[model samples]
Target: MTGTAGDVIRIAKSQVGYHEGYSGGHWTNLQKYSPAVPGLEWSQNQAWCATFAAWCFQEAGMPKGSYPVTASCALGVSWWENAGRFSDYPGIGAQVFFGSGGGSHTGLVYAYDADFIYTAEGNTNSSGSAEGDGVYLKKRARRDTYVYGYGYPSYPTGIVTADPAWKNPTAPSQQEEAVALTDDDIKKIGRQVVTGANGAKSPDDPTVEWAMSSFLGLTYKTARTIAADVAAVKAKVESLSVGGVDLDALAEKVADKLAARLAE
Candidate 1:
């Protein structure tokens, strides 16, 4: 399962077997519990929820640690809740920094009910049902600090769909790695493909893949894709031999496009 909120449905389903309701995208798995994959262990009880969520994202091939994780709910969503830039939840699939904002460590998001998200963390408090304290779901308590608000905006599959009154955190988050890009940030770049979009050449639009990820973190596969696309765009532009499309200028154009979108 991937770490995306989109994957939350499948991951929840895989573990719970069946769900019958949706409170604005909240899938209540039939309360069944399954161990997270081996690479990551959600086999515990009290906190395995976040671990389970981490595994989903890990499997999805997202960066191992992009903050705003479950554990950091208090800190909102950020690359490093410990480092500040706090109070932003991008979307599902992010590593939440839990505990009173700057209090505890990190965890992952698994599922959510209307007002809160269920975390799958390696709870130090308890282990699993096996040990009499198996991994379980805990709905978060919100803090206005924005630290523990919503999903991190920068997940590989994070898309900014309309925010519903339902679900915990209540909104998408804002977190980044080397660079910061927003849902709107991606759309502007897409518009720049004006001259080439309808044409086959535009399929190779430099920002397409990232746009598809909604400008969130790059997945392992997407990272390769980004690198390739960068090379290809450079090559294709260079091959055009069109004096008008300066390589640097093209980059600026793309940046401008993204900047414009971000402003919106």
Candidate 2:
């Protein structure tokens, strides 16, 4: 599995109960971290569902070609429409838009069923109105008139979970590494590895081979060969320069770290 869908949903699920504070202080802080929306004098009272969506995509390490980060729902819609990714079918990590004629609110789709679509929305609450207190995970009918389609982001394959909601965090390791890798190192390694797999270049991406050696703490050719052997056991990597190398697990290993890096 490419794991991109799982990665995006995991990040969004991490922020389920987040709410905006008085005068929108909380939402403003979310906006501050998003580089895409700038210069405008942002007020706590301003609409921020779009801001949250953009920030989540940014945090997911999704490239603009796959996901556009923007504050205006209309603008966000335009971006997906331009990319030809807008569609009626809601898939994991697809941006579910609401309203009609133009658009109103937007959110990241978490889970869905024939009758309803589960969502993680910002500037909304239990009442499910666009103008609300903060971020929430809500359920809306699939046939709800407010539904305006979606922005479908491409994913690698395996990350999507059967569970309908985000799971709790995993326990931290009590045993530390001999040399602990910094967040930056993890993120860099992840980006290099993912881009190597998912980038336009495909199997030619060097980091696939490079990361395995690094993860094994090996710097020699033999180590990479062994790594390729281990990877090849998992998936078909029969062609290209690294004839026997595989990347399915490599991408999953780096997904969470790469996601954290995007948040940074």
Candidate 3:
């Protein structure tokens, strides 16, 4: 928020240039996917865009985690229900929120044309690969499409606030925007599956947690949880046989889980 829109674009360009895209799987892939290259040493997968935004701020020498509720600023349509940034205007560095519900995909408000918004996102697409299909940019249509809204920061606003721009009545579906909460939250429910664990650490299998967490945005403590989960997946991948891991089935599982949680 301190710098101009051009500054944000420059930083984003630098970050995007730093990596060679990879299949974005096993949440920990980002660890090597980001830093090993160059500009994105801190680029990570989090529970949502806000947390990813927080990580970017930390990496780029911006104040991070200073405001708890302001994380919503990372979305497209910021409610600013909390006293944070982005609750006021739609700027280059604000968070973009879409849809309405339990979880929404968050992204850095990178660049914009007269009729569209160009975004820098980490965890989108079906391949779930790192570097994001090797193309460092994605665009959200602004005018006639389902743009929902825009947001900016007003107060001590480190996040974004809302701006009503589009006229489309059909908001994106919650499933279109939903990602899991953070790893810790999901592990809390996975506790029912643990059998052999002592009080040493959480017995919840880390692979599922990491997959789900990375599917979300890499939050703080939850980010590390994803790392451990990825480790578990890699550790067991050779031993596990290939089976009915169909993507549509996987998507259905994700949708069902999100639906159940949102309902709750």
Candidate 4:
């Protein structure tokens, strides 16, 4: 049978506590086993986050070249992007990239929520730095600047993503047929709507922030940060009363405007 995302995840989870050699200059079980797979033999003592991810795919029976086999996280990102398999949203078994230019560290995403992402990363420690020792399960804030994006594997069962363009193969009818939005489009739209709201200020209400975050698939922190001036304008908006106008109704109108902008 063909390997699945679950298979890769299971194999990665099983190696959670595995660490590098005590005094061997980053030596690892992965390095010891790298010779088994041709072209993967050079990862002996160097950074092994990508190496570990490649090994998990290998052990799970995924075909070679389906995923990038390199020690460099940046190369992994380029592989998926060039293949059109990169996404801003996290998916199970997706490779999560970190640091500047997404070249610092890499990990496999096991799960994600509105606010955080959980990962199975190798060459990381409890603090979750990209360069560390051992395999670890890490919980990270989704809005973390270090989190650049995700690289998807072409699993036999198909990949699921929050990107509207990359529809979940398992649930075709449930997805709307819409133009795929590039990563730039989504980020641009998200910033425009959030910043444009309340005239260059973000709406400070949690409800508004949550709604915008959900609609854009952006983290709550990102939404809030984008509209950093929300608090300064909140009191002004709340205190204004013109001809008995309902502020709640005005907020609803603002929300409608946001939706309209998003649809544009």
- Compared with the true structure, all predictions reach lDDT values of 0.44, 0.67, 0.45, 0.79
Per-residue CA lDDT of model 3 for 11-46, tens digit only, reads 555555333334545433233334432333444443
Q: Rank by lDDT, highest first.
A: 4, 2, 3, 1
Instruction: Write out the backbone clash pairs for model 2.
Output: 2-156, 2-157, 6-159
- Pick out the ten consecutive residues of candidate 2 with the lowest summed lDDT: 158-167
Q: Model 4, 110-218: lDDT tens per residue?
A: 8888889999998889998777778899999988898999998989878655556776546444345565889979766766676566355544545556667676665
What's each prediction's TM-score?
A: 0.33, 0.53, 0.38, 0.60
In TM-score terms, candidate 1 sits at 0.33
Give the winner by lDDT.
4
- Say which candidate scores most in TM-score: 4
Evaluation by lDDT, superior candidate among 2 and 4: 4
Tens-place lDDT per residue, model 1, 1-264, is: 444556643453344322222355543321222343443323332333444445455455555455323422233334443443233442343444544543443444554434555554433223322111223343564332423443443445444422443243334445434567887776666555532543434645645554545535535666676567567766877776576656776778767754664455
Ranking by TM-score: 4, 2, 3, 1
Better of 2 and 3 by TM-score: 2
Model 1 CA deviation exceeding 4 Å by range: 1-3, 12-53, 63-78, 81-90, 105-107, 110-115, 118-132, 144-153, 160-264
lDDT of 2 by residue, 97-120 (tens): 999732689998888888888988
